[model samples]
Target: MTYCLGLLLNDGLVMASDSRTNAGVDHISTFSKMRVWEKPGERIIVLLSSGNLAITQAVASQLDDQIRLPGGEKRKKGSTLLTVPGMHAAAKLVGEAVRKVYDNDAGSLQQHGADFIASFILGGQVKGGPMRLFLIYAAGNFIEAGPLTPFFQIGETKYGKPILDRVIAPDTPLPEAVKCALVSMDSTMRSNLSVGLPIDVLVAKTDAHRVFHRRSIGEDDPYMMGLRKQWGDGVRRLFSQLIDPRLDE
Candidate 1:
């Protein structure tokens, strides 16, 4: 289990993922679920994955291998992340990668009574194009984030979705959006044991074609601790101020 989120704001994109994977009480581990590919001034692509860890890792490996191939080889063989002309094409490339992995391992997992479960959030900018964000599923299908729905989430999403729903919009500032993402992740971590510490966050400014900020937030980060405390207190105060229902009257 994990918690990964991506926000598409007018200023740019913000992505975040928790680093915990738990098979059982005793079989827990930390693995960063964020993958990034950048061509400096040319393009920047970020992937946030959740679900069966093995399947997600395999999909990411497939994309990485394709990215490392020579340009002509990549084009001749298939579409690599770098070869995609736009964000939509890049999303299709990711979807195909997910399907390829499912074809290879889904049946074997099914035989053992395990399901082939995986999902991804892909967001970034390609030179000459506007920044875009996508939510790719296990079946080689995806949808882009738009004005009505300017964000996506995978894994333990329910615990953190309320804040995002109330705060995010197309015109939200990048910094505020990133803060919202962290607050979202923090909410998940507090309510769920499966989503743990050392979160990875990446932010990209619109048309920058590169990552503007990246950070690994650990358990002891002062800023995170303060934010959590403040948010919790604020929520409690707000709840207390609300009028109670009077059924008897």
Candidate 2:
């Protein structure tokens, strides 16, 4: 299981992912689910993935192969992340990568009684276009974030979604969005043992065409610890203050 989220705000983007992967209680491990492709001032592409680990990793590796050559120069032969004209095209490239991986591995996995499941949250800005965000599914299809839906999440989403729904808006400030993302992740981790630390978070400013800030938060991080305690206590206090409903009334 995994928990990956992306927020598309007027200020830019906030993307986060938990690093825990588990087959069972006895078999638990951590793997960062975030992949980044950047061409400095030219473009910045961030992808948050969930579902089958193998499938997601293969999709990311496929994109990385086409993105640049051994010497780091951009590839010109195919529609690589670096060659995509805008965020939409970049999203299509990601979708295609997902399909390619599915075609090659899905049948084999099914034969072994497994399912070919994968999802991605793609967000970033191209040099000439507005910042955009997309949710790409296993079937090579995707939906863009819009005014009414300014965010997307994949995997173990139920526990964390409430905070985002209550707090996020298109006009939310970047710092506040980042804080919200962290809080959401904390809530998910508390409810689902499958989702754990450390979390990877990325923030990009609109039109910057590059990441504004990136951090990996672990259990010992002071700010995360403080936020978790404060949020928990505050929520409990608020709940206690709410008048109890009366069935008789």
Candidate 3:
């Protein structure tokens, strides 16, 4: 299990993912769940994945190879998503990768009760266009992030999603979006034992065409420490300030 989030912002996109994977309580390991493919100035795509580690890795590998899309009959070399012409095309390609892996492994994995499960959050921008974000399923289909829903989250999403819905907006400033992402992550880490620490984050700004900043936020990161405490205090304060409903009743 893991936690990954993609925030659609006025500036561009912000993506973050935790790196903990556990087969059992006694068997645990660290693996990167955040992936980036870039063409420098042409396009930049970030993918955050969760669920069945093997399945996600297989899907990513097939995408890097740019597998023949049933009829597209074209492929890429190291041809990860960054070369895709636009966000829509990139999304379709990712969905295809999911379908390919599901076809090859779903049945066998299901027999073993592994469920052949995986999901992805893909976001970035293409050169002549605006920024976009998508959530791709194991079924080879996806939906773009929209004005009403400005973000997509996968994996251990419940705890973090509340903060995002409460604080984020389509016009949020870039720095504020980063802070929101961290706060959201902290909430997930606190609530879910499976979603551990040491997070990977990528921040992209519009038309910059590449990642703006990427960081590994450790459990001991000072700024995150400060922000976490502040959020806790704010929540307590809000609770305290609420008028007692019992009096009205």
Candidate 4:
């Protein structure tokens, strides 16, 4: 299990993902779930993945490999993320990568009684295009984020969704959105062992076509520690101040 989230606000986008992967309690390890491709002034793409580690990695590899192919081969394969015309086209490439991975591995995994499970959160901006965010599922289908729904989560999502639901909006400031993402990630880490530390966070300003801020937050990061403590205490205090329900009524 993992927890990956992306927020699309008017100012820009915020993306975050945890780094823990485990086959069992005894076999736990850390693997970053964030993949980034940047072309400076041209385009910047960030991918957050969750689900079967192997499948996610394979999908990411497909995208990378496609871009490295020679010109003729690349064109035969269609547009790669870097050459895609817009964010929407970039999303289509991601979906195609997911389906390609499924086609190659799903049968073998199912034969072993395992399901082909994977999902991704793709967020970025291409030159001449508005910033966009998408949630790509196992079947290669996807949905774009919009004003009404300005955020998306791809894995172990329930633990971190409430804060986003209450705090995120299309107009939320980029800095505030980053803080909310961290708080949401902390909430999940506290409640679930499968989703954990060493979170990767990326922030991009609209039309910048470059990552504005990026960080790898470890277990001892000072800001994260303070935010965790403050948020927990504030929540407890708020809960205590709430009026108790009238049982007799």
Q: How many residue pairs of model 4 clash at the backbone?
A: 0
Worst 10 residues of 1 by lDDT: 69-78
* Clash number for candidate 2: 0
Worst 10 residues of 2 by lDDT: 69-78
lDDT of 4 by residue, 1-249 (tens): 899999999999899999999988898999999999999988999999988999999999889888875663547433788778888888899999989888899999999999998999999998888999999999999999999999999888888889899999998998899999999999899999988989999999888999899999998999999999999999999999999998995
Predicted structure 2, TM vs. truth? 0.95
Q: Which stretches of candidate 1 lie over 4 Å from their true place?
A: 69-78, 247-249
- Candidate 4: residue 52 lDDT (0-100): 92
Candidate 4 lDDT for residue 9: 92
Candidate 1's C-alpha lDDT?
Answer: 0.92
- C-alpha lDDT of candidate 3 relative to the true structure: 0.87
The list of candidate 3 runs beyond 4 A from truth reads: 67-80, 243-249
C-alpha lDDT of residue 245 in model 4: 92
Global fold similarity of model 3 (TM-score): 0.90
Candidate 1 has a TM-score of 0.95
Between which residue pairs do clashes occur in model 2?
A: none
Off by over 4 Å in 4: 70-78, 245-249
- lDDT of candidates 1 onward, in order: 0.92, 0.92, 0.87, 0.91
- Count of residue pairs whose backbone atoms collide, per candidate: 0, 0, 0, 0
